[model samples]
Target: MNGGNFMSYVIGIDGGGTKTEAVLSDETGQVYARVLAGPSNLNSGSRESIEGTFLKIFSEIKNQQPELFQHIDYCFAGLSGTENHVNKEFIEALFKRLVGGQFPYLIEHDAVNALYSGTFGEPGIVQIAGTGSIGFGIDQHLNKKRVGGWGYLIGDEGSGYAIGRDALQVIFQHYDRNQKETILANLIGKYFEISGDLKDIVPTIYQAESPRNHISALSKVVFEAFDMGDTDAKSILQRAAKDLSKSIEMILEHFPLSNKQVVLVGGLFNRNDVILPMLEHFLNEECELILPKVEPVIGSVIAALQQINQKYIPLQK
Candidate 1:
């Protein structure tokens, strides 16, 4: 590649379980174009399906702006479920083949991109609480640590699934006690639009195709109930915050940087009104919370730029 072309552009991709997002940017970190594709997580979909998604997104970009696509000099991808070395290798090889191995690239787990996005590729801790929960950190020495990314079956203590599962348990307990209908119960019923006894909710959830996602969606109802002054709902969120805080604590135990900046990401953190204050209460005095200035996809771009020794100020909207 010529020096001018090499210095012109880069690509950053954030591959999630549900969808994939890509950003095309100039050397100065100015975004040129953004594209969306289907899920590319190897654990969630087949190799062919993931490849197809990437091809489709890339084709769109090429067709829309051929010059920009041609100038893309570096690619950095953060993919969910690529934590295993073999899986990561497969993805890297696949992209290399798809892109003709022309541009240099790096593939890493999605959490790494989130961490980079939160900390701008610097040393800091990041806690993600979306459909799943995990705490990741990097120290000034470049040491990395992870806490509680075991998925829904084992861990994900402070995730949306956890909060929804706890809310379901509370609703069932109310049903078993034959007590007056609580706000949580009513909210659950309305959210699910169930017409019969609440016990039917058990089969509705248990028999769902994607039980994790189904349960995670119910977290919105829990939040609504909390806003309506439901004590049980408040307790559930509080416990979730405490659990997430514990994950942060665990990561801190490994890094332990004074006045460490911590970044919170994912859908659960969207309810900052409920979770942020609780998280602040639980975090150590030396830990400070910082909001993400850009989305994780842009963070991937930042990481890609770092690979080439390029620096760009992130968007701070």
Candidate 2:
């Protein structure tokens, strides 16, 4: 695809803490190419690292189809950790410098993209429980509210990291008390290949480059143990569900909407059997639950379209 004068194209980027996704599309909303790169979250890495991530993605596209790069009309980026106004402005400036300001662009929080993707640009609430947890919503008046998403240190309750952290605490408590072996303890140890003295787990976590991602990975182990009917793992999930539900409730309270559709995103919600039912139980039918039908990257594209007063039907892929 060469840059033809008549050809109109756009790009949407979903930048996360772990990785970044870019989707190239056209005026009709048909996706042409997709690419992935390292984390672009401003808070997760240095400015140089974040800039390199975007450059890498754009360079790959330029190299593959120079015409598409040249003809791009708009670019929308929903980047995690860009919630801070200073960070957002810095990223916008960096992107303009990197891309030569050839196309119109907008930068927003990743949760905004997720909310748009969940509701197809309609007003609704979206709760994310991936490596981190956050709740975002848009009301009928177009008023937007954000709840939670305070990062892993003080907040992000009910996130994968939270669940895994709770599981780890359970194992350590058992070890500290010299209690009998528990399924959670064994599963965690086996998953990490740690044996004998459990005290070594401390350094293993503290010394990791991305401790949050490492801990979030353990959420899978929690689910696996839960599958085996482990009571401790189930309890951890129950707590996570309750925490996530509270976030949802907080967003709803801040933005009152009757029968609002609630969209669930992130890996934690992948196991509907365990988390979804509990989330619903807490919601008590206050809102309708919706599993994401499209990726957040596409939501970025929709946001870009909305900027130009255009609309497109989201095709589930």
The best candidate in terms of TM-score: 1
Q: State each model's CA lDDT, in order.
A: 0.83, 0.83
Question: Per-residue lDDT tens digits of candidate 2, residues 51-153?
Answer: 8888888888777778778778788999988888888888888888888567788888888788877777778899999998999988887788899988889
RMSD of each: 2.6, 3.7
Count the clashes in each prediction: 0, 1
Candidate 1, residue 78: the lDDT equals: 85
Clash pairs for candidate 1: none
Indicate the residue-level lDDT of 277 in model 1: 93
Clashes of 2: 1
lDDT of 2 at 53: 89
- lDDT tens per residue, model 1, 236-317: 9999999988888898887677658789998998889889999888766557787786789878887788777776564454
State the lDDT at 128 in candidate 2: 92
